[model samples]
Target: MFDKNHPHLFGRLITFIFAFWLIIGIALFSLNDTPAEINQAKAQTINNVGAYFWAGNVKDLGGGFIKTGETLLEGLGSSIIRISMSPRFRIDYNLGGGCISNFSLETLAKGPDLNPILTNPSFSTIIITAYDGTSFSDCETKNYLYPDLYTPEITAAIEQEYKALAQYLGTIKGKTFIILNWEGDNDIYCGTAYGATANSCPNYQKHIEGFTKWINARTKGIKSAGVGNVYSGVEFNIVRYLKNAGLPSILYDVIPNVAADYFSYSSYESINELYSGDNGTKLLSDITTAKSAISAGGGNNSNFIIGEYGFETLGREDSKNKLETVTNLLHSRGVRYAIVWNLLDSGGGFGLYDSNAVLTPSGKYVCSLYQGSACFIIQSPSSTPTPAITQTPKPTTTTVPTNNPCAPTSGFASSCIEDGTKIITVAPPNISNSNLNLTISIDIPANKNSVIWPTGYYWSATLKNWAPFTLQGNNYPGSSWLVNSASTTLSVPYSNLQPGINYIVTWDYIWDGSKWLGPPCSTLTNSLCWRLETFIRP
Candidate 1:
């Protein structure tokens, strides 16, 4: 009531209004600064992230299959539930029941029943590994030598039980990834000492045959049962060097025969290699080799799955950084999915979370990548004004040479030698002009099981390295540059060819879903060059 119209009161009121508006304006600016979405492409990148979880049973909270009311299982589920609530994160449920004996097939069959929570709409996909307690090395011994344990009748019974489990899984209407047997190679290689006696030792070939039979039977049973919305595959440990080089029991022999929708391999090399300062080059090479083998075996259409990968460094920060680096590497390589090895650190050191369901450092980093925040967001000045969006300019097309001189040379080294019928030809090897036009033609074998595509490699004399050529052609849909035809001819132009220096142009082919197969043109192989050339002035 004091001086309502007084000059001093009016001035004070005006001052109060100005200060209030200024505070509100500053808050609005702060709110706007709270990390805007960087781009739409990054937002979609987090969709398929997943992890593995195993909750202990009642008797042992740290080990044992899931039993209702088990505190560990409940805690594990709670963690999964929390992760599921996070956008773009899913849980990979390892069916512990499979680890039990065949006598408990029915109990194992109930494993899916225990995951009712996973069926919720929030969970977009479920990846279940149906473990068969029999390890790969034990496959031949248990199924053949030990007749009492797995007789013909008993094997048939086990097949039927797996079929039942598959049928149950198919009933759930969502994208589902099922690994029929996890790490079958381990059973063959790890369970037995190398060079042990025949009876007690691992018969690598026999083990492969037995594993193939088991996989085929299980695959057929699941298919015959009409499992819908399910992608099935068998998981193998990364191929051992000796096993791949000399054994007939390789993945190439097994995968093509079975009707697997995809192939999966577990990679733990990064765990040891990361600390030594290797940034997944070894892991990537392994993956490339595996894909090449699979594709050579005619599993061209099969996608790849990184069934398991994890790391545990000396410090939590180190572990988190490693996780971020490797996960990004996997995603960039066209891997369909990567499930972290374990959700809880079982005291052996790879778990993303502690036993108490709290996220460890690696887990937090993983969670951030999945949520599209820690990896995707770009921090900006809170006070910077938002820029106006502009239309993107259309790319201009460059005209490439249609004719090139190339000739096949015997001196060229290649990891994969060309089959006699499938030849790589480069025309007019010795060239004088700087605008070196090269044409490469590949004769696709009529019985070629895989879709063949053209890929070229050129040796950089100056750089002393072999660099891959950028092919010009219609890319196979959804693939980088792979094609789905019988034969392909590519014209390459090298305008930067150095005079008086020898250069090599190596022709190669990539079978769909695999690495370069016909020739190893890059530094990946030490084989003698198969395509050699020198550009000289006339």
Candidate 2:
């Protein structure tokens, strides 16, 4: 009896020991991950996250030296960093020791702790400027025009510099995407004035002619480099086209005329004016319009990018919201890449972090996207002293039915409608950007009979046959319906719906004997007709 009991107890002890060891191993593996492993894990979680942070106050954080640029990169978990270089400005372009070229790629790459940025496998995208001009004040006389300023000799220098840079980048390990682009819409095109009319700008025609030559030279330099991973692109503030319609726009005039690899939109137009008020309708339309223009200009839609998007915190209190709106729209739209305007706040509150290096709401939100949760990770000390944390009042909350179909989900803002009810209003879809660039029309078949309702009714649609349908509350307020056609077309911008989700659009009509009117079909009877269309917004 003693021998038998001893064998049983030994077996039980062995089993328990094995289980304990397995648990310990898991904890150790998770906790002891190397910095590279941790960074790789973080990189796998997000995509196309990047920003442009240059020129800010410095901070001394003891032994580990950190600049605002470094902090910005770490905080945002940036996979891409846009670095500008002024090759001509560099006193020592080859050996790289100079004061005038502080922001050049060579300078930044060789700076303290920044070499890792170039060598590290984490950063997937790097946009480098081939040539950056501080100001083209002499353009009034055409002396600063394209061939004049960027003569063959200058273009060749640009090419050789870029080729060397490309060769160096190629020697580095890991597959990295590199774009050699140049100054976007600047005084070269718009002159010294910000909102100058196209015609009124000094030598506008000559400037465009000069720019066309300048961009082509830049593009040729980049292409001539022959780096497999490197491509040339042109960046333009898209608003230049919208504000000056019928005039030669960047997409219309230059892009089609050049052989650049991609067109980067410095998307201030959408962020400041077009995207707001509409549920991303105008923004989507504008992008579509821009893509069409690019296609006409000999570029494909896939190569389009939002190169720079940001809002200044100087006077705009809703800067955070505005930033999030554009970011979310781009993500949802599946645009290849987007870079925020800046990282540090110098004078303009454009930086995600203030001059003190403290996290701003916009910065925090960006960090959350990278980390997959709430996070604020500072790699080094900022130059400016950090301020004391303040507690602000929480946003007010309004209660709505959990089952409400029109209720917003994650990544969306609050809606005007609070009460849970059936659809009540409809409008002819005139999905137009503020200035008009794109349009989408949804047609309701004419054969379907009207379901008349006097109180109110809304055109509704369900998500993959979910119990409730999601509708925009503000889409209907007054009577706006078209009855004079075989199929009444309604406008529903793809921006209204979330990405990766299946949506079904259902429509109903109310007739007053004279004309079919009222919006949003209500579920009054079982006999009502339903049209099912599956839409996945990118």
Candidate 3:
């Protein structure tokens, strides 16, 4: 009101608004192609979003952990941040190591134990996969351990916690995802607690399949335990378990497991203690071994994640460095997420948060996961090209006599000539960064008044078709243009295109010009087009 009262300020404000609008312009996403009922759509991912919490290896990495943890979490940038925490007793990363015993994820996520924790924004995909103090409950449903599929107590716990997590997520759609990490028994040899049991293998899968369906059917916003961000006590173990159970990629349903799109493995600096090394037969190269298997399977099969990879605090500086190196390496290769261990007070020197609640170097490493958005390439605009126009002759205005023969090679209208393989010449072969660059050369005789080139040619990215060169070069004296080819070299600014985009129509030949000399390549138009009869690949 006061600014308006002064009058001049109001005038200045109006001018400023006008100037701002002129300079800023409008964004495409916000545009409305409003035709009363139509509106533009934006893309969104519906299945799952995963992030890893880096905690494990606090004490062992040594001092000044608080700052590091903060840095690490902040680094997650745009990824759905996460925390695969455990009760202090079993999996505290601060000092004590992760689970020594196992329990169902349902038991861990149940009521009374949530509330305060769910409130933390630092958590998105929360899974309490603890394996200490408790053993896999064999007690079955109705009344027996490992009965129908799950143990009774185990089923109850999973049901209870699942309901709680679902209800909590219901309040905030898209903001967070609460995942239940199913437990695996310490079958040290095969590395799966279920130890090849039908229930643990085939039956266990069926149980999970039905369970997720049942849960999804019951709730509205609640997502099933999509089995995401799985941390391994070992990576190979997951593969080994799958192979042992005869579970194919389809069964892993990795492609369909929208909720659990990533496979995790556990690799501690303690790899030697848990896995058999080369001394035996096959060398257990930790994550390197696991990653290779996943890659060889298929690119679309599943994205690998080094979910729980941390070393003990007692680990030497050399060991600690190795751990960090391994973590970064896996992360680079589409291992979607990587989480250390829980931040604990004591036991294993491997917590991200130390005994004093400080974040270790590993903590800083983890915080990096939470901090910023992932690097996105500025590629879309440069790759997509505007389609070039090629003239299509509509059989001219007059009709030809039914008994008439093909047009003579010596005259104007030559459309009747057999469209035999016409060789088009290309210029500037080597393209930078794989951009489509091309120029076509077609044969044309010169000097008899003028020469004409063909209009209309096909271009195929898959088949690699060359466009007809329609432009008539060296005809400098007059603006009377003859041949025109539907060809151009686009400077696509990016790396190698994926499978579907390997080949492209480097040239499209077509002409609408009236200068139709003749198709006889040996005569008048020969010099113009003949110069381009052959082309060599770069």
Candidate 4:
């Protein structure tokens, strides 16, 4: 017992005892930890991510078409997931080509419903676009608008299904929210196609009435579930609301009529209004105006959310910077969530990643945010080399007769003028609130036949669509003001303007004889040949 190995036995026993106590101490310390503290240890951060109409192709499983939602949810790294399903899930309405028709909705409504997304523990927020009819052409031709799919049976089915969904959402641990919405303003409820003027798009009046009832039914259904975790929302393209001052605007027309819990803005125009390296001036102004509009329409502005925002063909570097800038500004404005347009490139070029699985600069930044890692800095592009100047003989310009009241003036109306035989200006010089009090000025040379007064068409660069207007008291399209008159000014009070975005108003005039009496500006691409005025709302 006095051997060297035998003498160390007591010391070895003490060392073993110390290791056991150390393990026990660590376990006891963990007992007092919060979920957040444990998540911090695992480096889990909050992620609000969504896709645009993409849940991958569903597989035909004979009984019904279904997909293992987990496969796609695994690497998404999102705390919120957005998916879409066609309204014609139970029965085909023959809604035509552009409409999204599949069994995804039925599968969600029946067995294994909501489980596709809820089973994935990583996601706490779920947004479902229950109606995916996004065809403007179909709206014109077949009247394939949101109202077309609504019926007594469909409404009941929607209510029953969402009730089940809400009940399930209530059982999820921690804070969870589910939002249900439809196609939004993507369908052309108001525009030139239906000859929509400021007062009416008469042909689609039934559609609007039907839509209001349909939306109310949907919200009622969601509320019937009696769960606080579920909310009803309506998506509106704020840009469209601003551009088209005519009928069928969800923000102005439908929202006030429905009982939606939140307003989601598909904000494409907001992205277009941003300048490089913006310090949140334009973006914040747009959001503020949008909130005011929502509030005025009786919607809860505090619940405003960005349903969609993205950039395509802006190059990955610029897109990344723009997206990051927008997100930071939205966060500053106290927005709870925002969904990028899509995850994978599906030809619109709005995807975070390309078809080949290559991560775009924007995608990389988003991924970093999801993973709680610092984003890689995208270097600004180098300035292009300026071309050397070359001297050439100057061509002589002929002097034209003057009396152009539409001449460019200083300050707010600096860029309001367009000159020719007939001159035009959208607003008189140096005046604010020009958009609200829209003014169009024109002058014609003396000793000419009486000129046709101009009719206004509002152009939305984002939608590449024109909203044609009829002069007050006129029911026909292409209605003009002060016909067979010259050298006059016309002012109309327009109250539906959304400020902080540039608007292009093209006034068509048949000059003493302007170029070949071209088709209406809405149908033609040569917008420059027409008398146009562009201005930003102050």
- Choose 3 or 4, whichever is better by lDDT: 4
The regions of model 2 sitting more than 4 angstroms off are 1-46, 58-66, 87-116, 132-144, 175-177, 180-183, 190-194, 239-245, 274-278, 313-317, 372-538
**Candidate maximizing TM-score:** 2
- In model 4, the runs with Cα more than 4 Å from the true position are 1-76, 87-106, 109-114, 132-158, 168-177, 188-202, 239-248, 275-280, 372-538
lDDT of all predictions, in order shown? 0.46, 0.48, 0.34, 0.48
TM-score of each: 0.50, 0.53, 0.36, 0.49
Give the per-residue Cα lDDT of candidate 4 at 427.
Answer: 57
| Prediction 3 global C-alpha lDDT | 0.34
Off by over 4 Å in 1: 1-44, 55-113, 132-155, 192-200, 243-245, 248-250, 300-302, 372-538
The list of candidate 3 runs beyond 4 A from truth reads 1-113, 125-164, 182-236, 240-262, 268-303, 313-316, 345-347, 365-538
Name the weakest run of 10 consecutive residues (lDDT summed) in model 2: 384-393
Residue-pair clashes per candidate, as listed? 19, 15, 83, 0
Report the Cα lDDT for residue 441, model 2.
27
- Give the winner by TM-score: 1 or 2: 2
N/CA/C clash count, model 3: 83
Tens digits of per-residue lDDT, candidate 3, 313-339, equal 233232233344444344433445555
